[model samples]
Target chain A: MNKYIKLMSFLLLIIVTLTGFGLYKAQASSPYPELKVVTTDGKPEYIEPFHFLGFVSDTQNYSNSSTIVFKDGHSRYMEDQTFLERIDFNYNPQLNDFITDHRSFMRGKSRRTEHYTETEQHVIYTGMESDVYWNQPSRGLMTIAVLNKETEEEETFSVSLGSDGSYYEVSATYVNYPNLTILAATNHSTDISEQFVYTFDVENPTEELTETINLTQEIDSNGGVYFGQSFDRTERFIPIQSVRQTDDSEFDYTEEIIGYFAFDTQMQELIDVPLFEEDTLLFADNDKLYVGKDLGDTIELHEMNADDQNLDLVGSIEMATPTIGREEGTHYNNLFNQNITLLDGRLYAYETQYSDDISRPLFQITDIKTQETLFNGTIEPKDMAKHDSTNIDVFEFRLDTLNN
Target chain B: MKKSLHNFLKFTNFELERLSKFLFALMGITFIANLVGYIYTPMKYMGKINEYIAQNSATSEQAIQQYGPFSFYNALNSFWIVGPIALGISGFIFYSFFIWYREWFGKNTFAYRLLMLPIHRMTLFYSKLVVVFIGIFTLISTQMISLFIGYPIVSAIIENTYYVNQSLMEAVQLHPLFLYLFPLDLGFFLTINAVGLVVLLVLFTAILMERSYAVKGIVLGIIYAVVALTLVLLPLFLPDLLNNHYILYGSELIIIEAILLVIVAVLSLFTSRHLINKKITV
Candidate 1:
């Protein structure tokens, strides 16, 4: 019994201490006030059950910062999420089941979400890799891995792009069975970046075709090419934008859109996409691509038809043109700070609306095809008395899509 | 089964008794070192801040601007706070091998006597495993409990104006090294501790292998360790080797890796049991 005393005491100590700590940790509440989006004008059903329009708090300190996700008329903090929910925050559990384990560590495509695609019979992962040697030309290689869903057989293919540059960024991947396509943007030692579409036969590993998407002749001095931000598996066209420096200052140069085009995935060719107006924003939603032009009072949406190489009128969404500068020298109008996104036949515009006295973070969801403003709401603290809007940095408030 | 369970508990207690002195010493070291850290960190910070204020004719705020507010995280990063932690980790790691070796090499060659006891040989293994686990948990609990006691002492020592109020969780969150050791997330905690358990099992198996065989057994033991490690980590590197791609999802990979570790751990236990029962010589 005496011999057991020390062991029993130690065990009891460990169990009690850790249990108390665990309970304390579990019971601890976040100091930040809970915030929820209050829908004033429209139905809450407009915000999808699974889908959420959320803002990551930009509090100066880590302790005060939180992620507020608004869905179904209720707001949830990321910290309050369960273990599975926290895991789901990065990758959907069902999607994660089929997706590659090392997606986060993929070379040059770590930040990209479109590096993997699932076809009817195949699951594919593709990325660009480069090996840089000291005082020598770096070799760029296209890395692709294809898995047959039926047979459960997998094959890896690597295509060399000669000794051009060290850094290659793979933005998106598409699999059309044997034909695997990748969009790679390469940056060279000359401070210039070029985009290319590399097509390879997954069945026959040797054959490769590379098409230069960004033509040097088309790009005038101080001009660079950029692809659209959205990547959809079903979309057959990639939005292309050519920009040139409008202001010539070396450090503080402003870029202006010089050209717009849609690169057809099926045809392997580029078709001119007519811009609705200057400063037009392009977003790809599922199979349809839309161009949005922010007018003072409304944002006009124009659908880009790749077959016709022209623009078709979609619909106009009514929104107040934010004032040019600060409201009474207190709040700056940063309404169009984020890209107006078109997702799943809906248009979402999230902005922190600033006024003379108060700044309200708000979101508007509209049916893109119908142009009907579905839901209009402002994010506010549930306990309004505890809300300190000043502590919220409006500039740092980012509205991110919860999951793709 | 009941007798084995009783014997297992008694053996576990005996194992605890053997390591109790060293465990107590580790706790004492952790306490004194962290206490020194809590005292010295702020005093040195103030000493420098005050000197700067006097030299430059600056306010505390300006000096604080130069050197950030004295947060508990500042003490957390100090050597005094982390040194004993490192020592404790190294101590346990060393003892993991020594715990087995000391019985064979001790004055009377106690391994034969321990084996002769009226109990299943597997009880010896389970008892040692539990003792090591208890020792580690005790150290972890001590560190956490000490932090609860020390944070207020640190705050009291530093001037209220200059000190940054941070909870223990916040301080841990701020320090990446400590966060890895003491993760807030349950998933991470479970995953890390499971990996640690697998490591301890592998180490135990290797020690038993060396004990069972002679000089040539050292090489055999090394091979065994390499094979065990490769088997446990095969799920992680399997896709890369086989297909040159990540075939499994993160959760699937984690699940497979866990299963592989369990398999390897069971194999190690069986192998060690066989060695202790048959192959080991005094």
Candidate 2:
């Protein structure tokens, strides 16, 4: 039995060894890894304009088949990542789309107005204005429309540009003022306050650069002053044909501002003022004084009385930054910090309240000098269609008409 | 014999680096794997030897049967353990080749032939056996030391004695014995491993003796192995063929295994003896 056992034991070892050898020959285990491509910013911005969350398909086919998403109530678009020629669409279908089957969705029926700022560049959809819509309406679909900046002949629609250069249709059609003048404001949208968009009659161009805040002013002794907005924008701001040339051009395009003025009424005067932190991004002349305070909530107006450091707690109200597009315009107020601005003897305050979809009221136009409301209404946020997640210049709008 | 043993000691005394190398490799690889495994895929990484206990940690008897620390040690000490491992199967192959070509037995080549040796045939056998056994000794002792150092090595990283204790205790629970001793159980395992070489040696002896054709000797050895396999199968496979409902418990299976090992050791030694003493003719 022992001999038999010995013999058998020998055989089993051979089997195990052969198996081990086979395994060794076969090779050990491993888990090879791979990589993915992603783009960081893709919302409406100033330089190159399109609707919010809007990118034309690929620039290769900018006129046809490319669509934009504007933020409106009860709407969202989800498509697998695909190649697009001009991917952005307008908030108002009437502007970009015609009655359904009558027009092949491929060749959308609207007159093609906005061509790509750069030919053959792929247009991506970025969701810039969607969040603003979500902030306002809280829930429910809001309509946001997009129009080629060049097609905007007059007060065409309620609009707000995205981080990407695209105009998103907002549900607001603020009582369309022929000319707007934003003197001062606080407590408003995250984007720059565009109280005015002055047109330069000569230059014809298109671009997208979203976030912008432009103003020029002077102050007096008691923090009382009148300042007019220069309906100015960069990227979309056209320099006069002569001004668009070079830095040394005859027409000075140093910092494009068509019209600006500060009335000498409620003026605060000081010999000289403390310079702000060079690093500190000054949103406006008033913003330099409004530091460390929660500006996201409300835009505060204060008195720069002599040495009264705390900007002499001059009465502060809300200010609203207005958006425009194809829809009529309006405004909204915030629940927390309000955008407070003093314009033309009136305090235009806006308190933005956010929801799943945003639809804010325009500034509460109250006269600070007389304490009366000149205009108070909700402003239009971009419809869901104008939203994009990738394109950064959503606010880049073009001018079809110039002012006298 | 004492001189032989001394020489053997001297031979292995310098082997610490090699042993340490194997142990280091074993341990380093294990530690890294354990570390990565603990971080990435803990379930696949750790304490696998203690699986029986892991699945039934709540159970008492089954837990005690595991050899957890040894498995864990084997993993971490692979760097050091690899050297000793080279002396195992590869060593056997090398030694077999040496013995085959050298005809250190019947009639090949070697300075210390049984005829030329100034000692009895058995003395030479005992000497070689001692050397081989010493190799086995170093292998097992290194394993034990590695198993011991595993805690300290792991502690360097974790700095948690309680966790170490828990892990070590679980490792211990997996296997009841602290050490697997030689010349009996362990010795049996090695001898069983050497049986194929023994059968070859026997044929080699038959070649020198010309008692049968050298090729016939190989054929006979193969036939013997097949016959033996049939006998072993009678109890395992034939029982099923007979349809008898016999069952074995844990201890009984272990005892049977032990017997089998002992049988291989005796048979291999017996064959070695015959090969050593066989008369050389051609």
Candidate 1 per-residue C-alpha lDDT over A249-331 given as tens digits, one digit per residue, 9 for 90 to 100 = 76676666677666677787777666654456676666566776766567777887767756788888775334221122211
- Supply DockQ values for each candidate: 0.21, 0.01
Across B115-159, the per-residue lDDT of candidate 1 in tens digits comes to 898789889898899899899989988888888877887788788
Q: Each model's number of backbone clashes?
A: 0, 229
Each model's TM-score for chain A is: 0.69, 0.22
Model 2 agreement with the true structure over A233-312: per-residue lDDT tens digits = 11111111000112447764232112212221112122232333321101122212322122333333444433344454
Model 1 stretches with alpha carbons more than 4 Å out:
A31-35, A38-240, A244-256, A261-338, A341-347, A350-404, B47-57, B177-183, B242-246
Q: Candidate 1 at A370: error in angstroms?
A: 11
